[model samples]
Target: MTRMTRLTKWLLLMAAITLEVSATLSLRAALNHPALYVVVAIGYIGAFTALSFVLRAGMGVGVAYGIWSACGVALIAVLASFVFGDALTARMVMGIALVIVGVLCIELGSQAAHTRQTREGEATP
Candidate 1:
């Protein structure tokens, strides 16, 4: 693919991540305030839509979802802590760091697997 195409795909992937993050926050809000259920539902629906576009841009579902969810979870944890005044101790920060590291490892592994598969596919042809 051309550089522009690759960039576009990446942008879409980021959009997907953004949507998922928004949906998570909205869902939390809706849960607390039943009247916001419709807004939350819409946010989630938009999130899935963005995710679908990202997949269409050629990202594997596992890889995409892993990155998306990890980011969303991390952001939501921090946001929730701030919004709810939940304890955010040093240990909690350490745990979040670990979560990020684990997710990065998963992304790296998945990327390696994807590159291998692409090489194999090329060789087969």
Candidate 2:
């Protein structure tokens, strides 16, 4: 994909993360107030729509899903701690850190594979 396309895919992925997080928070609210279910549904639908665009833009499913889920989990956890007064224990923090690291590893691995393919193509006369 062109540089612009790649950039756009990444942006869409970010939007997906935001929408997913919003959906999760709305879910929490909906538990106490059923009227919030509409908001929750809208958030989830928007998130998946943006995620499909990211995948359609030539981003591998694994990498796209990894980033989307990792960021979504981390952000929701942090937001929960602040907004809902959820516990923020050391173990929870450590788990979040691990998830972030794992996603980074996947992303780096994908980039390395792409670079190798580009080099191989260049060397093919």
Candidate 3:
């Protein structure tokens, strides 16, 4: 598989994240009014399409999924409080912070493994 450059991969991942968040928000809007289902479906389609591109760019599945899911959960929670008037409690804030930390750990671990493999390859005859 041809790997994309890190910048390209990150850009794709960001796009995927944005689309996924938009989809989740649209889902909320759709719940109250059935006519908005089309918007929700389109948003989901865009999200998955972008995510597939991100995966194809050779990002590790675990890292990509961890970041995607963690960020999505956090973003949705905050957005819900603003858009839906849902309460954002202290517990929710703490949970979101933990999720961010977990995703960062996954990303850092993936990067370390890649760096080690590159160093090993360079050391070989």
Candidate 4:
């Protein structure tokens, strides 16, 4: 199978994150409306499906999962603040920033390691 482009991988990750966040939010809303449980079910299922595609696209599982969880947490917190009047303090923002930075470091480190492995493989007889 053809490898997915970098943009496609990232886009799939983003879709996964969005679906997860929406599902979580729907869960919260379902407490009141109850009918939104349908959305919660659909969203969670779709999110996992998208994540599977991301993995099949050749992105490392650690990087894909880290970014997916980080973005999902951040988006849920921020969106919930607006949608449900949940508190979003400065400390929470800082924590989200740290999570994002940590994921970025993992991705960069993974890329560097892959490059080194490729070079070493090429150098071997």
Candidate 5:
């Protein structure tokens, strides 16, 4: 893929993550002000739509989903602590760190697999 195309896909994935995080936060807020449910609906719908585009942009499903979910989880947890006064305990932080590490493994593994496939294909013919 061209550099621009790859950049566009990454940007769309980022948008998906942002929208998912916003919707989750909106869901929390809607508990107090029911009208915020509208935002929740729109955010989730938009997030999924953008995620579909990310998949269509030639990104592998496993890598895309892993990054999207990992980012959404990390962002929501940090934002909730600041926006809602939710406790961000040390244990939670550790869990978040582990999640990040897991995502990194997924991404690196994907790259290695792709490289191996390319090399095998080149050697075949």
Candidate 6:
């Protein structure tokens, strides 16, 4: 990819991740009222829009979503425990770690597929 495309992808990825974080935070806040589907819908739509931009910039959907969700979950759990005084147990921590591992595996798998495709295309005569 061109440098500009790479930069744009990175920017879109950041935007996607930021929207996810915002959505999670808002949903957490809206839970008490439970009449905030509009707010939740807005958040979800923003997140999906940003994600589409990122995917359009060449990110694989599974890889992008896996990484985005892993990071979001970790951050949400941490903030939930600290900001909302939600329980933070060893089981939860382990679950978060497993999610991180899964994300990494998705990234690796995407990279492998991308590299294989690149090689195959190059070999076409």
Question: On a 0 to 1 TM-score scale, where does candidate 1 land against the true structure?
Answer: 0.77
Candidate 4 Cα errors over 4 Å, as ranges:
1-4
lDDT of 1: 0.78
lDDT of 3 at 29: 86
Clashes of each: 0, 0, 0, 0, 0, 0
Give the per-residue lDDT digits (tens) of candidate 5, residues 47-105: 99999999999889999999999989988999999999999999999999999999999
The Cα error of candidate 5 at residue 10, in Å, is: 0.8
* TM values, all candidates: 0.77, 0.95, 0.93, 0.91, 0.94, 0.82
The residue-by-residue lDDT of candidate 4 on 23-124, one tens digit each, is 999999999999999999999999999999999988889889988998889889999999999999999999989988998899899989889988999999
Candidate 2: give the clashing pairs: none
Give me the overall lDDT of model 5: 0.94
Error of 1 at 121 (Å): 4.6
Give residue 54's lDDT in candidate 4 (0 to 100): 94
List where candidate 1 sits over 4 angstroms from the true fold.
31-35, 121-125
Evaluation by TM-score, superior candidate among 1 and 2: 2
Worst 10 residues of 1 by lDDT: 17-26
Q: In angstroms, how far off is 22's CA in candidate 3?
A: 0.8
lDDT of each: 0.78, 0.95, 0.88, 0.92, 0.94, 0.82
Residues 57-87 of candidate 1 have per-residue lDDT tens digits of: 7877887788778777787778878886767
| Poorest lDDT segment (10 consecutive residues) of candidate 2 | 1-10
Candidate 5 regions exceeding 4 Å error are none
Record all residue pairs in model 4 with backbone atoms less than 3 Å apart, i.e. clashing: none
User: Per-residue alpha-carbon lDDT of model 6 for 1-125, expressed as tens digits?
Assistant: 89999788768777777777777777877888676656777877887898898898888777788787888888789788988899999999999999888988887888799899999999999
Question: How many backbone collisions does model 5 have?
Answer: 0
> Which regions of candidate 3 deviate over 4 angstroms?
1-4
Better of 3 and 6 by TM-score: 3
lDDT by residue (tens digit), candidate 2, 1-125? 68899899999999999999999999998999999899899999999999999999989999999999999999999999999999999999999999989999999999999999999999999
